[model samples]
Target: MPDVEDLFVEFETAAATTFRPPGVADVQRRIRGRRRRRGLLAGLLAVALAGPASALAVAHRADRPEPRPTPSVSPSPTGRLAVRTVTLPGVSGELAELRFVSARAGWALFDTCAGADESAAGCRRTVARTVDGGVTWQRSALPAVPDGRVHLLPVDAGTLAVMTRVGYLVTMDGGNSFASHPFDAPQAAVRRVFATPSGLYLGCPPDGVPTTCDRQRVLRVSGGLHFHQPPVTLRSDAENALVEGADGRLWLTVGDDDGLTVVTSADQGATWQEMPSVPRAARQLVLAPDGRDVWLVRTEQPNGVWRLAGTGWQPGPALPDDTDGIAAPGAGLLVVTSAYGGLGFVTGGGYVEVSELRGPLRTSDPGTSVSVLPDGTVVAQHGRTWFLGVGRGVDRSWLQLS
Candidate 1:
C-alpha cells in the first residue's frame, strides 16, 4: 500500500496544477459592469474574507432557498415585542422590496436578469401579491420597460403606487390595470416612493445625460396622477428610502456617487432640513412609527451597526450580532437579521443590549427584509420569498414572509 504522506503530497500537487487564479482585471470589469447596471436600474441598491470561490459559495448560501426551520425562542418578562423568521414563496431573481397593507394582504417588488428577454416585461420583473397572509403569492404583469426593476407602495387595500425602471404607474383597482405617467428621462429610475398622509413622494436621481442637471429633483404627486407640486431639489444624488413618521414629517435618505446623506422635511417634502452625515454605505433607511427615532442599517460589515441618529445625530447602539439588513417594528423596537445567523431585537433609549429571538435557521445567504403587520406579527423576507413567525406565541409558521 502507498504511504499516506506520499498520497497526500500527490493530491496537493494535482489540485494546485488544476486550479488557476482568476485575473484581477477580469473581476474588476465585471464589478464595474454590475455597478453601472445597478445605477441605471435604481441608485439605491457585501463582504466576506473568503476566496472568490468560497465567497461565492457563501453568497449563494445567503441567497439560497431552504425549508423553513423552526425558529429559536427567547422568553422575556416584558414581552414588549416578539421576533421570528417567516418564509414566503419567491421567484427566480432577487426580491428588492416588500410591503404589507394588513397581516394577510401585501405586495413585493422583485427584479431579475431573466426579464432581459423581450417577450414579457415581467419575464424577469414581477410584483407579487399575497391575499391570504403570505401562504401563497400571485405574480402581476407590469408594463414593459427597458430595465427590469419594480418599486411598489401600497396606498390602501385597493390602491397601489407602482414605479418601474422606465417610468411610474398607479393602479386604483387592485393592480388589474395600470395608468402610465410619462416622465422624460433616459433612465426613469426611482429609488424610493413614499405614500404620505399629505401625498406621494417620488425620489428620483438625475438623468443619465450629464448636460441636463434640471431633472435631478424629488417629485410630489397627489390624488392619483395629479401633479400637486413642482419638483423639490433635495440632493443631486439618488434617494434610497422615503419614510414618513406619525408626526407627519417626511424623511429621505439619499445615496450619491460619494456616500450616504440624510435629510428630513417637517412640512411634507416642500422644504427640507439636512441632517448630519450618516457616514456609512447604506442600502435603506427606516423610521419608527412615532417619528422620533431613525435607524440606518449599513450595507457593509464591521461598521454595519445600526445607528440611531435623530433629534441629534449620535450613535445609538450596535446590533447584538453583525447583520446585513434591518427593519423597524415601531418606535424604539428594531428587528435585525444577521448576515451570519439569527434574528434579534433591540429596544429603549441608549439602545442597550439585544436578545435573540431566532438563531440561524440554516438559511443560505439570507437576503432579509422584515415588515410588522397591523397585528404586530413580524413577517420577514429572505431572498425572493417571505415567512411569518408569531410575535409572542412562539408558534412560527413558514407562511410566505413577504
Candidate 2:
C-alpha cells in the first residue's frame, strides 16, 4: 500500500504535467517587430566590430533599447465547459454522494436497498468510478458489508479517503484497491468526512445510538491515523455535507428539528463558530474554491430557493425557485442545477436558465452535484451518471446567463 506522502507527490506531479506550460511563441509574436529590429541591430553591431564602419553601426544599435520579452498570453481553457452524464446500469438505489478528483476521474455512491422489494434480493451498495470523464463507468468492488453507506473524500487527483458504515479505508492508487484501517469509533457509521489541509474530520454519533441523538460528535482524525481526544460536540445533528474552506477553516451544515446551522472551525475541530440563522432548512452546503464564498440550498421546500450565504454567514442573494444545486464556476458566477434537471446561471439581475442539456430528470433524484475543473469544465451528477456539460469560459462575463 502506498503511503499518503507518496500520494501527495503523485498528485503534485499529475497537476504539473496536466497543465501545459504557457506557449512562448505567442509571447514572441506579441513583440515580433521589436525582436526583429533588435536582431538586425545586433547583426549590424557584429559586422561593425569586424571593421571600423561596423563598430560605429554597432554603437548606434547598442544605444537602441532592448525589446522586452513578449508577455506570454496563454489563453485560459476555453469553450462551454462540457457536461456529460453516465448512468450506472446495475445500481439499485439513488446515489447519496458524488465527488470528483479531476475532470476525467470521479466516484459515486448509491444506496443498496433504496428501491429494493422486500421479497426480492436486497440491492448491494454500489461504488462506481470513471477514468475517462463520464463516458463509461465501472463498478468497483466494495468491502463486505450487509448494510453500509459509502463516503469518499478525494485527497488529491489519485488518492481518496473512503468511509463505510463498517470502518475507514484509504486508497492511494486511485480507486483500484482499498486498505481498511483498524481505527474504529463507537459509532462506526460515518455520515461525512471533511478532508482539510490539516487532517480528516468525521461526523458520527457519539455513543453509536441513533435515538441518543443529542450525543453527536465530530471525530478528528489527525496525522493520518492518530485519534484525537474529546470529539467536537455539536448542539444539533450535523448535515451530511462537510467542506473545508480555502481560508483553512472547516464548514458544514448542522441542523436538527429546528433549522439549519452553519458552523466554521479555524483550528481544525479544536474550536467552532456557528452562524446566527440560515433562515431555511439546508439540503446542501458548498464552499467556493476561494473558501470564503458559500452557497446553501433548501431541499425540503418545493420552491427550490437557495440562499447565497458565506463568510460571516451574511446572506448574498436569494436564488430563483426550482434551483436544486448551486456551484461556483470561478469568479462570482453561480451555476445552479434546476429541479427539472436543467442547468442555469444566477446573476445579480436574476436567475438566467440555461438550456436543459440532459433530460426531464426525476425530482426524487438526489440533488445534482456540481464541480468546476481547473480547465473550466462543468461536471455534474444526477444519481448514477455523471455529466460533463458545456463550459462557459473562465471569466465572469462568459459565465453570464445568455
Every model's Cα RMSD, please?
14.5, 24.3
Candidate 2 TM-score, true structure as reference: 0.52
Query: Who wins the lDDT comparison?
Result: 1
Q: What tens digits encode model 1's per-residue C-alpha lDDT throughout 241-277?
A: 3446657776655455444566777776567777666
Backbone clash count, each prediction separately: 21, 20
Candidate 2, residues 302-336, lDDT tens digits: the string is 32334344444444555655554456654556666
Model 1, residue 191: distance off in Å is 12
TM-score for all models, in order of appearance:
0.55, 0.52
Task: After the best TM-score superposition of candidate 1, give how far the Cα of residue 376 lies from its true spot, in angstroms.
Answer: 5.4
**Worst ten-residue run, lDDT, model 2?**
51-60
Displacement of the residue 104 alpha carbon in candidate 1, Å: 2.5
Model 1 per-residue lDDT at 181: 58
